[model samples]
Target: MTITSSPWVHPEPSQSQLHLDVVPENVLHALAAGESASFVPRFVSPYLAGPECLSLWRMRSGQIVDTPTDAPWITRLMVDPRVTAPVGVAGFHGAPDDTGMVEVGYRVDPLLRRRGYARRSLETLLAVAQGHPDVRTVRASISPENTASRALVSSYGFVETGEQWDEEDGLEIIFEVSAG
Candidate 1:
């Protein structure tokens, strides 16, 4: 099903509490000061202080980094409903490429996994991508050993396309979900 027409795309008033705040280019500095450049820190997760986040922020578009909320794709903190702590991080690699393909990625805190946050966040991300006319496909690259991840995306209509090798991630199985 297309994200736009998916029931999970739109969260109910209560479940809509999760917010996606774009991580700025200097996210490390922002997080150090308890913020995300443009917004105050809603929650703090250990991932925010890791090199992974720094790397992701560095790859962000300068223009989008300046005006984070407007970024087509960037790492974001997934604030819990209580609004006092971060549940996880979620985002895309960037805007759609020339081939209209965009990569979707996310990671929920280990303690918070299996509670449906990843699925919800993914649905929301898909909706955001579907909103853009240029995004025709959403790709997810999962490690061969990550059965949970492979199963997760597959449940949402993502089909295995092929595989590729990465220096860091090793062998990865590529999955693609086409826009409807």
Candidate 2:
């Protein structure tokens, strides 16, 4: 139950319900092929299986630059380490940008929601963000209509900074919390 030591990747500490494993594109490939690995996803996550996740995988696969193995930061699978059953996907939109801002996103499986899994998973991710020296702020964009999401982040000290209209997500209330 040891976590990886990569700076950009974090495996959740034992206290968390699900292990937050930083999933690289290559690992995603293995999962997609039904191949085995220590972190291979055991449960099918609609968010992970959707086109958005596939597009992220494809994008990461193409950006084979000098970025650290964990720099992509596009996806992670939350799994029960004992049984290796994936509960959801959570990750940053990308690594911290020039402004030292990184967007966080998470989706817990419908069957697993309301059980505190999302909170634990997000807490783990937030720690990772705060640990990174480059991260000044961790951002979350929740649709005004999504009360659950707003509550989840607000509990973590995130405050509404503003709003934005996204083509796919429509109007979203942008929130942020200092990474420190």
Candidate 3:
């Protein structure tokens, strides 16, 4: 949703608390390099180095090359404030398009799934989108086989508009809802 704001805020500490620590270029590089333990952001848990997260870092590190350092809002660790450790990753696909459409992506560690972290991550992204002036619509392109994710989006009032074939993720159901 083109969250132009800096220092993205996290929810206040509570049992359900989750925060995002922007994964900087160097950290992305190190994660992409497969050395999660030695990464610059020592507070980031190694769970963030999961295969999915590794791919995200590899791709995002390349994305920041010619872009503004703070512009992408690309990837952040979905952290558990109680222990200050990451349990997942969440961020927009990119800035909003001409139609004010922006897509959201989030992946919680497989081992840590079903603890409501995914829901919290989606809530955070939706809050960001709703507050951004440029965002009119938020999108979630989910794999049809992913019932949990499908249910998640639907519960947020997103309606399925159609479907698309993705080279990497195969067929996906596209859901959209007004950002506000």
Candidate 4:
């Protein structure tokens, strides 16, 4: 896969040489076995087991792909090479309804926080969503206390709609980025 430079609405420079590739199943198995340790904390949960992570990467050609089980969206996002990396992952309740309105989710490594990776990744994800005729909107659920997360998504045009109790996390503030 080849990474091409594209117009980025965010402040960061568009990465011209970065390509987003689908993670191979073997790599995912290795990660489940705890062979690789990069970006481990950035995963959700099932990924910890190594089967469901379905992780991808932003790399130049000839780079080996590592699988991280915690990031399932990597599978869907890989539907388009234009999606460089997955900033987040969401499951059943957080997934899109029948209307194709999916949720935007992410988890940055604690040490990697505040480095603009999330923003850049999110910008790419939003761009991919906008390009898809099926996606009408992208939603995100964040804890009110997660100031950094709130700021990140809000800066990208996600607006607060309300709050609700999530089975995984208690009360979360709902935000959405509409295609309109």
Candidate number of the best TM-score: 3
- Residues 27-122 of candidate 2 have per-residue lDDT tens digits of 666545444335534544555565545655554445434455444475667776554467777777777789989899887767778977778877
Best by lDDT: 3
Ranking according to lDDT, highest score first: 3, 2, 1, 4
TM-score of each: 0.75, 0.75, 0.86, 0.58
Model 3 Cα lDDT, one tens digit per residue, 34-100: 7777653334565677665677777777777756543456777776755546777888877778998
Root-mean-square deviation of every model: 5.3, 4.7, 2.7, 9.3
Each model's total of backbone clashes: 0, 0, 0, 7
Better of 3 and 4 by TM-score: 3
Please, what is the whole-model Cα lDDT of each candidate in the order they appear?
0.68, 0.70, 0.77, 0.50
Reference-based lDDT, residue 161, model 2 = 99
Model 1, residue 76: what's the lDDT? 66
TM-score of 1: 0.75
Residues 112-157, candidate 1: write the lDDT tens digits. 7898778778877877777778889999999999998899999989
Candidate 3 to native Cα RMSD, angstroms? 2.7
Candidate 3 regions exceeding 4 Å error are 1-7, 10-15, 40-44, 69-72
Q: Distance (Å) between predicted and true CA of 126, model 1?
A: 1.1
Collision pairs in model 2: none
Residues 1-180 of candidate 4 have per-residue lDDT tens digits of: 112223223323455322223334454445545554554332322333243332322210112333232233343211123433333332212223579787765554343356555666677567656765666888878999999889988998899999999875699999998965
